[model samples]
Target: LLGRFFEARAKGRASQAITRLLELGAKQARLLRQGTQVMVDPLELVPGDTVIILPGEKIPADGVIDAGATSIDQSMLTGESHAVDRGPGDEVYAGTVNQQGRLEVKVTGVGPNTALARIARLVEEAQATKAPVQGLADRISAVFVPVVIVISLGVLATWWIATGDFADSLSNAVAVLIIACPCALGLATPTAIMVGSGRGAELGVLFKGADVFERAKEIDTVVFDKTGTLTRGAMTLTGLDSEADERLFLARVASLEAGSEHPVGKAVALGAEERDIELAPVAGFQAWRGLGATGIVDGVEVAAGRARFMADRGLHIPDRYLEALETFERRGHTAFLAGWGGEVRGTLAVADTMRESAPAAVAELRRIGIETAMITGDSRQTAEVIAAQAGIATVLAEVLPEGKATELARLDAAGRSVAFVGDGINDAPALAAADLGMAVGSGTDVAKEAGDVVLMSGDPMSAVVALRLARATFRTIKENLFWAFAYNTAAIPLAALGFLDPMIAAGAMAISSLSVVTNSLRLRRFH
Candidate 1:
């Protein structure tokens, strides 16, 4: 019963982060009725019901926007600290906040169907799926009892013959069996694993299986996904270039982007708004994937996209403008060419800033002798700049989203055990494919499903903390096993001799268990 209590306590502590997540969920929501909005419980909502999402309010359900535009702070779900802009037709998730502007959302998911709910379910499943550590004690236990029986028989026959006393011979053999009960050996590995798992939970690092404690030490390389892993993943307009009237050029581009939903488009629109430029109304807005948007703004056909996208439209890009584009890209900014009337006007640049803790985190991994590399869908120049900022020297750039797992496999084929860290829908495959997949940040359900470890915080420094903790915990496990086995091996022979008694052997057995438990508790003090 005491052992069961200890095991239950540790398992409960290991799920603290998941409990904290559940607390953040809103219990009610404001719903849009036939002609007015009413406050109601979240359970009352159903698919197709329209919900009114005001500024500074949590979205009650996952659905597409019916009207209005606002920035939704999805940091808790996506681990993206930035507020993402959502307009009509854009999807809004339950548990995310509408930072600005009034929005009417058509509910597509509610109650158990929400992304937040799914994430909670994933956390529960992760805890349930965890298997106990298979240690040296279990293997020994299988044969130790049988071998002890044989030894006890041999001791009884020898003692009976030597002394010709039946009572003394039987008493000596009983003492030997009692002293080698393997009580401490049974307690050793489990106590340490429980405490270590709980300690990991306290640090917002969840160990899904006992195998992680064993496998983490073998990791030789750590692969990080660029967008949400190293960088803030919130793209903001940083630099812009124009041959004439820079503000006017920006206003023209922003007008066309007003109808678009791409991150780059939203960043451009936001940049123009900051300059207080009134967006010129646009018509016939056409958005092409991999290219940019083309629309009629202020009676002129204006265009914005990659350099190749501009060229395809028969636009003449100036040599100076081309040079400026290279300059922005070389600096790790995604640049676009804006044009009108067959002439390139200027360039717009946006960049995802590096997280402040990225540098220290990368350095820590390197100091510990783990090679770090970044795999990203971003262009090579952009990947290089961000990698340098994060102090990562090895960069695998221009890899498509689907190709991330392939890169991890390539590294594995080279005889390197890798740990991949990422937070994004597209990163799901790579997260599962890695030897040790760490789902960084808020731990979205999809990413969590594939990850071996889930980081509750968005800070990259937590990765360093996790690796160090794994090594420390595994060390404790080994220490406990050693003391347990050594104590049993030496005591059994002394108990078999006529010099030792049963009472003293029983006391020693209890003391050995107490020592193992006390040593395992030391992990709770780990940072």
Candidate 2:
């Protein structure tokens, strides 16, 4: 009976030890994984191949949509819940998803500069790029392990040489080494960054890495891209003539523009769809690119294009409608008037309108004391119009595609920490040049690759949320630094004076690192 009891006790101890070993292995594995290691190889992706994506699956790389129209749920890359419709020529980001459609996309970016590659680069860069000032914790950790080793050796040697206490010295040395781990110090940064990045991802904000997070905290000025950044980027039918049976005129115009690829044509078609109008097929179809289209509708030669198109046809477009057209054009709208047999019938106003959230987002930034500015290729009048609507005080209009980088440099030279928010092919150079570059959802992969942070919602308003998260993260870093530095300052002197044992110093080091990690974990609770 005694033998059986002893055997059972031994088995229990063995099981407990095995469990502990497994747990320790898991912890180490997790630490290694979070240690800023790159896992995916760039060469794994093939160029010019069709990348297939199913519903709810993240796009593994950057690609151009080759076929199929689907509602993409890009909330993982863009914070909005509205499933955006995508077709051929549209670029999809690496981490976005096909919400309800199966898209066969042609891989465009295959190597390090691909959207996914950019994401990886951003994350690594953020981690490697430390804040301007080192945290107190990291400085302490720098000297911590070495000092602990020296003091432990001295304690062991002094005890054995002075009192011949070999066992006592060993015990004291082991205790000191065991307790003085810099686990808290190490945890401080990775934990906070992981938490912040993860939370931002959930909210549709992708922080490339730590540097962006750190720099974002210090941003005093925000520059916006006009078209897709602040606006809906979709043309809408703002107004129409109701006095002349505008329904028939709109339907006739829609029929004329049915095959045209101009943005204004598409907007007219969408407006007609909303009104549930069935447009009759038109004949003698002709397109005047950059102007409009014309056709024979209901036996009448109906032409829908710029006011000049009507005037050229000898149609006397009334001064009243012309004035309205001028006003809409000044506000960044494209005006189209419809006419039959050279007599002006009606006018349709179309414009890419600003988002409902834009003005409110600007107000929120103002509330936080961040100055807002606008940068665009739009004419001065149009830029001023949008600026006024959004309550922005500074406006830089008529900026060409390549001019954005120069503007960013100018701002940098002026000593302002500028953050640029934009979407589109033209915004790539500026996105790369800004102190902090933000890419909105649905932009080109190149733009996403160039940005420090990608806003999945594609809404500029999310920039405000990002700024808040960054500030909070910076504060956590400061706290951790203080704890790390203070521990070394107090414990090192005590150890040198022979008052503090090696075991105590080790314990202090461990506590500092652990505390940093715990503080970082707290960021997970931030909304």
Candidate 3:
């Protein structure tokens, strides 16, 4: 019992990454109150409070920036080491470092609701959810004790009746009892689970339970969510329609999107800012959810969003512009229409760049005979474009977040076992519904819950490492079970037949348990 307690505690020590995250935040923040800087506890801060952040300081809360521009190191949170430029209205998460420049940010969330806090809570929950693995020895031990007792009594009765020698019968019975070797059976599964899971942790792959390792061997189809899974979730303006005046169109769109917080709008505004284009002051600013942003720019009403937003507002597109838009869409770019003064000014295309490691990761899975598929909420053209770059052959496009699970069900009915990989709250249902769900460690709390395994590195290649490691772990478990059962099965009867003495039986039982432990320890050598 003491040995088992130590083993469990050792396994738990591998999951201290979240505890390290909690230590990264600033304990005290510089609060900006009516133009005065005041020192206060970060916990005392609330939403809408203007907090001043400085260079080499940890952000105290999640909020949209209000002033100053700085490059923030968010690798601790997103697993991407690049410093992202943050300015007014850009979201900065808690626990990230402000590398240079000072900024005043309006707090939107603090404490438990902050992204850093949520990740820590999710990680702790994932660690606690692992269920113990049962081994072949444990199953036999449940009913083997009574059977061993009966066999011993039968041996004693036969020896007494045949020769009437009490010493001989009792000695033979004692041999039978010592040769049972239940200890070998008991240690087989747990020792392997301890070593294998610990090894996985070392590689940044966390198995939620010992059972999850067994399921990975059966995965045939690997489904990936697009945004953030294959491509960087951050969308940026890639190109502007050729017909539009670069300066005039950008100025109109950026001014209209000034007050909008949507990713598309932010991309346009950010693009304009990057080019040093000064935005005009706009009136009648409005944001259409899932559509576009509209406002008056330079005394002319301007709108920028998807083509549907323009159609809904009675704006018409020329055939030439529509053809060019399709060309942009084919290259995996999401195009938005920017029109003003009742005429279609031009189309702007924004695209999420594919992760640099995505292609190699897909190729590795394919080499192992596992097929790769991509599912996304983006249009069919955009989805295919992203999939092509990643070397994924099958694409499920325009599928809503809720419908991803439905697609998984369709694959299940076809006798294909699927593994879903994602990094969002919306992917929770599909992640839970798949045969094996892998969550990016940097994702939301709900995503981690639905995942059977958490890839701590948040890299797609880690998913491959996870599956291969699981199969290897399962193979190790089988070997341990085989050696344990084979040893006891052949040795028990030899002792009963007087081929082995009581002392020899005792030594053999101890050897059998030692062999099982020694074999399970081999999992430590796994790469």
| Over 4 Å off, model 1 | 1-136, 242-262, 272-318, 337-346, 443-449
Query: Tens digit of lDDT per residue, candidate 2, span 3-111?
Result: 2332233223323322332222101100012334333432455666565666665665667888777877655445577778888889876655667777777766654
lDDT of each: 0.78, 0.68, 0.78
Q: What is the lDDT of residue 401 in candidate 3?
A: 67
Worst 10 residues of 2 by lDDT: 24-33
| Candidate 3's TM-score | 0.74
Model 3: per-residue Cα lDDT over 87-176, one tens digit each: 987988888899999999999988887877766554454444432346445658889888888988988888888889989888888898
lDDT of 1 by residue, 342-417 (tens): 9999988888878888999999999999999998766678878888888888999867667888999999999999
Instruction: Give per-residue lDDT, candidate 2, residue 130.
Output: 50
TM-score of every candidate: 0.73, 0.62, 0.74
Off by over 4 Å in 3: 1-139, 162-168, 242-262, 276-314, 338-344, 443-450, 501-506
Q: Candidate 2: where are CA atoms >4 Å away?
A: 1-77, 81-180, 237-326, 329-349, 443-448, 493-508
lDDT of 3: 0.78
lDDT of predicted model 2: 0.68
